[model samples]
Target: MPRGTDHRPRYEQVAAELREQILTGDLAPGAQLPSTAQLMARFDAANATIQRALKSLKDEGFLNSRVGKGVYVRNQPPLVIDTGAYLPPDGSFSYELIDVETLSPPADVAAALGLADGEEAVRRRRILLHDGQPLELSASYYPADIAANTALSKPGKIKGGAPKVLAGLGLPQRAFVDRVSARPPTREEVEMLDLPVRTPVIRQLRVVLSDDDRPVEASVLVKGAHLYELQFRRLVSDPEANDV
Candidate 1:
């Protein structure tokens, strides 16, 4: 609204203003946003501008619009997943490794771990909990040769944490490559996780690699949206001063 200022896209400006209000908690979750006509009058902007701004917010998952109902703030909070950390540092969460079996690797997983076609791999399933709350459902696979030395070849050998069991077998914990995505849960996952129909779950596929850069394990973790917060931190470097 300042005079003599360069102009940007009107919709972007409107969206930014609304985004600030939402983020500042001025507009709480599930709170209804101003109607398009109301916002137009308030901002003295065209209907197209307001609609575009709202559409952008909706696409970003900050707002939801229902037919015949006005736009409202999204009920679900933003997901914060931590991809940088490993599980069970000095005994954190309770992990139950249910079963392990030698099985043919699935096409997608086989490609991810760079396994040979029709190769036998150890498939281990686990159910992990955080303070009695079901936190994650996981399935992990390791190359047959790598797992053959360990007890994973036997069914139900690793009935707790795979990392702990592997460490006991002289294979220490290693680095991991993680891929993350969000989707609605399948019927089985929904029931297993005890999630509601509308709740969205996050899936992380992790490939655990040994010190030699050979992938030794592949894990798929399905986590509920509400139970965890992901955080990332970075150090800022000042160009003016070379000092840390």
Candidate 2:
């Protein structure tokens, strides 16, 4: 912890040490980090180096500075998302209904939902919360004809989720297709998610097909990639194992 002990820049050395501590869970989520004075003393580094080290972690999304509160480790444990599963996979999550409106679906969304050109769809937008922090943005598109006068079109939380709503309309989803990608977050997404600049997001485009193979629903989810992981359960055939 002496100044210039390592050939690397003092700030990088300090940042590297702190980064390891966070990755190793020595500093747990919401744990307040050491004060600048403490870090400077421990590292034998100047104020500028100590400040730069803290800023590095902040830009990496490992730490956040509160206006009144001191710097603390961000509660960014990866959320486990089951592909094609119902929203709020567990009870620990809180959700907010951002918007529900009839709008001209984006070109790709319209195609996924099997809507014609210029055709409108009911768009339902919701955001999921964990520990009172936003974790995901989900938007589902339903063909106007399919959603009219149903719970899907209503501007309120659906009692049984989208699947149940479709089931009520005699169009239960028999299968779903999901395609995932990642990209830099937009300005609006940065604000909505309270994410660090330059952070990338995971995008999952899902299409739900009815029993007759009709694409009844399509949804686009933008998730905090740094703070989430996707999990899937697969069943593989092993007929030989059945022989006894």
Candidate 3:
């Protein structure tokens, strides 16, 4: 055991330490870990405890074991979500339409769509899949008036995605704002995403604005916390002034 005051269980502490190493590339992808006996000696723990730690990491997709060789770090790369664009999923991804209906949305979503109290909105619920794995659970809301009689109110994918549909209706998407947070996955989320137990979820509430600053769409996007990372890039407004 390394000298420290982390009060977690010994196995959990060992798992956390090894997880950090894997994430930081200290344990490179495909690199085999030390032998079980070496790990037990290094952590000053019993062989069973070391095995338990390895099992935890393996369950989390950080490590893999060979039948006769050894445990090695898995070559898994976290998905990078670019925050500045509304790019549609490429060929490797697909959308599974869960449902479409008109209903009064949550308060925050209502506010985002500028809906009046009790005013209904059309919601398109979908599961975004990347190479057949669930990547995100998304629910996009549209003002009832704007969505009525359109594909957005129906129960199938919109050709070219919602942006194109909105554009065809003369409400071309101009910009979007996202508010992101992370918390424990809801029961439904855990089931839908097939997330590991206790894995948190990252939620992004995105509001899309059209011409004349009209709020045309709002979506609630949720992804497993461990599977993706958000990327944001902004230009320095005063680069000259920032010179050190």
Best by lDDT: 3
Ranking by lDDT: 3, 2, 1
What would the TM-scores of all predictions be? 0.58, 0.71, 0.88
Candidate 2 weakest ten by summed lDDT? 77-86
Question: What is candidate 2's lDDT per residue for 1-244, written digit by digit as tens?
Answer: 5665568778878988987787667998789998888998999999999998888778877889988779999886546778857565567787799999999988888888888788899999998887788888889999999999998998989886888999988999899889899999988788898886556899999999998789988898998766777887767599787788
RMSD of each: 8.5, 7.0, 3.2
Model with the higher lDDT, candidate 1 or 2:
2
Better of 1 and 3 by TM-score: 3
| Error of model 3, residue 169, in angstroms | 2.0
Regions of candidate 1 where Cα sits further than 4 Å from its true position:
1-81, 86-92, 155-161, 164-174, 233-244
- CA shift of 135, model 3, Å: 1.9
lDDT of 3 at 117: 95
lDDT score at residue 225, model 1, on the 0-100 scale? 57
Cα deviation of 46 in candidate 1 (Å)? Answer: 26
What is the C-alpha lDDT profile of model 1 across 91-198, one tens digit per residue? Answer: 446667677788897776798789878788888887776566566798888888778867667665455556776677666667777777889888877777777434
lDDT for model 1 comes to 0.75
Could you tell me how far off, in angstroms, the CA of residue 73 lies in candidate 3 after the best superposition? 1.2
Ten residues in sequence with the least summed lDDT for candidate 1? 85-94
Query: In model 3, where is the ten-residue run with the lowest total lDDT?
Result: 84-93
lDDT of 1 at 235: 54
